[model samples]
Target: MSKINLKKILTYGLVVFFIVGAVGNLIGPEKILEDYARWGYPNGFHLVTGSFELLAAILIFKSSTRFIGSLLASCIMFSAILTLSYHAEYSHAFIPLIVFMLLLVSIYLHKQKKLL
Candidate 1:
């Protein structure tokens, strides 16, 4: 596929990904709560994460702010990767790592498009 198409696909896909992440964190399901606790995060930290994820999703959905959104998402994904890796939760780390890489590509595409 063309770069334009690829970028569109990645951008929309990331928007969806962040939206889901935001909801999952905001909902604070038992498994997620336990994971956050296991990672030594303060109680209610998920709220902050969810808020940022939601912001990223919003920014990403807008063409004018896609790069900025990707940057914000990259930060979150990086933190997740670090936390998971530090805890030796490699399996859990995998998804964040993949998302982080996709965010990087999305950012690059935005830069190439001079949308940054």
Candidate 2:
């Protein structure tokens, strides 16, 4: 497959991932609420995070706004990593770190004009 096709696949994949995450946050699953409580965040904070994720996912689909979307996504992942690490939840931190790396890759590809 061509490089552009790869980029499109990655971009769309990230968008879908963020959208699903947003839905999960908005839906306020019990485990998710428990995690937030354990992390010392207010119960309502999940809604804020979910809103940002939903917004970022929408912006990521547009070439002109993809950079901003990636930046927002990266920041969110970074925050998760920091929080998880601070709480000594190293195992949980792994996934956020991976997500952060993916966001970086998306940013790099966008800069290279491979993705929107």
Candidate 3:
């Protein structure tokens, strides 16, 4: 596939991932609630996370705001990695770490596009 197609696919994938994450957090499933509690976050903290995720998704869906969306995603993933590491959840941290790297790539791609 062309580079443009690859970039578009990646962008769409990230958007969908964030949207799913937002919906899951907003739904506040029992496991998610338990996780927040375990992480020392107060109840309903999921709402805050969900809101941010939703915002990120929206920003990412717009080419003009994609960089900001990636930045927001990077921040969220960084926090997740730190929290998991502090709590000795290395396995859990891996996913966030991967996402963090993906966000970095997204930012790099955005910058490259800006310069071209």
Candidate 4:
């Protein structure tokens, strides 16, 4: 596959992931709140994060705003990973950290057209 095709695929996949996460948070507020509470965040934070994720998803779907959206989404994931690392056991934090790092790499590849 070509570099451009790989970038497009990754971008589409990331957008779908973000959109699904946003929709999940919106549809399952209680589950998200439960997870957040376990990580020590307040109930209101779930709504705020959900909104941010939704907006990021929308922005990511647009080519013009993709880089900024990817950066913001990375920030959000990084924040969540840190929060979980701070409050939860190490094992619980590992997955998020790995996921966030993968996201960072994905964004980097997209930016450099190296995904091919």
Number of backbone-clashing residue pairs for each candidate, in the order shown? 0, 0, 0, 0
- Tens digits of per-residue lDDT, candidate 1, 1-116, equal 64567777888899999999999999999999998999999999999999999999999999898888999999999999999999999998999999999999988888888943
Q: For residues 18-83, could you state the per-residue lDDT of candidate 3 as single tens digits?
A: 999999999999999999999999989999999999999999899999999999998998999999
Clashing pairs in 1: none
**lDDT per model, in order?**
0.93, 0.90, 0.93, 0.75
- Model 2 gets an lDDT of 0.90
Candidate 1: regions farther than 4 A off:
1-4
Give the TM-score (vs. native) of candidate 4: 0.77
Comparison by lDDT, 1 against 2, better one:
1
Residue pairs clashing in model 4 are none
Angstrom error at residue 64, model 3 = 0.3
> How do the predictions measure up, each by TM-score?
0.93, 0.91, 0.95, 0.77
Encode model 4's per-residue lDDT on 1-116: one tens digit a residue.
Answer: 64567667767777777787778777766667788788777767777787888887888788778778888888878887778767756676776576577668666765775346
- The TM-score leader among the candidates is 3
Candidate 3 overall lDDT versus native: 0.93
Ordered from best to worst lDDT, the candidate numbers read 3, 1, 2, 4
Residue range 10-96, candidate 2, lDDT tens digits: 789889989999999999999999999999998689999899999989988888999999999999989989999999999989988
